[model samples]
Target chain A: DVKVTQSSRYLVKRTGEKVFLECVQDMDHENMFWYRQDPGLGLRLIYFSYDVKMKEKGDIPEGYSVSREKKERFSLILESASTNQTSMYLCASSLTGEGHNEQFFGPGTRLTVL
Target chain B: LAKTTQPISMDSYEGQEVNITCSHNNIATNDYITWYQQFPSQGPRFIIQGYKTKVTNEVASLFIPADRKSSTLSLPRVSLSDTAVYYCLVGAWEDTPLVFGKGTRLSVIA
Candidate 1:
């Protein structure tokens, strides 16, 4: 079984603060992703990393950035958190190539920017 | 990723079989259909995946017709725990992020 763990389950921060959400996967997957889920909007991708130090922007990557310094860890960074940035953040990891398959998601972190 | 369409919501009773269908008119030949289940306050979990015909797993079964334009997920003998949102995805076998549209919110009542 694959396991994905997040650094925080719930977080609260003031406006203009820098926020970091971390994710770690037990399996040695090559692909990692970050997403935000909002009511009525479903889940929207924020960023994804195919390999170490390799990142790509998703559809809604305007307000967020990502880091993949190591194989098992991926981090999401908010340069300046705003109230509109409050959302449930999700992390997922998957294998590449012929082993390419569905992602395994971690329990999301609900962040609130006050 | 091809666009998918499913119901907004569905209602079912306990011990009854639930079938949620998804339509993907522009699904490519190499694309496969996958389903994920998500409860409130949690990330989605993989349920099943299939390309053509029937594919069964321990938790659920996936049914795809010959045309490959649509697919159906079947859950046998549902319980209250089965109440969750089900998302249908269509994509090639590659390392791409799952594109989740408005999923079908299924409520399994007692």
Candidate 2:
């Protein structure tokens, strides 16, 4: 079984503070993704990394960035946390190639920016 | 990426089969249909995926017709634990950054 783990399950931060959400996968997948889930809006992609040091912006990438220094770890960084950034953050990893896009997700971290 | 439409919510009882259907009218040729289940406060879990016809797994089964415009997820003898939100997504094999819409919420009662 693929195991995806997150550094925190819940977090609270004040406005304009810097926040980091870490994700690690044991399957050594080549693709890692960060998403935020909000009520009524569903899940929106924030950022994704295809390989080490390679990152791409998704639909909702404002105020957020990502780091993939190693194959097993991916981190999401908020430059300046705001109240609007409060959401349930999710991390997923998947193998690259055909018929291999099935992403394994970690338990999300619910971040509250006050 | 193809847009998917599913029921907002459903109700079922234990020991009964639950079939949730999703519609993707604009599904492309290379696109595949995948289903996910998400419990409260947890990330979504992959359930099944299929291009056409029937594909069965240990947890659920996916049935897609020839037109590929829609798919049905069949959960046999559902239990209370099966209660969760089911999301249906359609995308190409190499499409990065998946898009998930508001999923169907299934509430199973005892």
Highest DockQ against the true fold, candidate:
2
Q: What interface RMSD does each of the candidate structures achieve?
A: 1.5, 0.9
Query: Candidate 1: misplaced stretches above 4 Å?
Result: none
Worst 10 residues of 2 chain A by lDDT: A38-47
lDDT of 2 by residue, B1-110 (tens): 88899999999999999999999999999999999999999999989999999999999999999999999999999999999999999998898756888899999999
Clashing pairs in 1: none
What's the C-alpha lDDT at position A68 in model 1?
98
List runs of model 2 lying over 4 Å from the truth: none
DockQ of each: 0.75, 0.83
User: What lDDT does the true structure give each of the candidates?
Assistant: 0.93, 0.94
lDDT score, residue A106, model 1? 99
How well does each candidate reproduce the native contacts, as fnat? Answer: 0.76, 0.81
- Chain A TM-score values for every predicted structure, listed in order: 0.97, 0.98
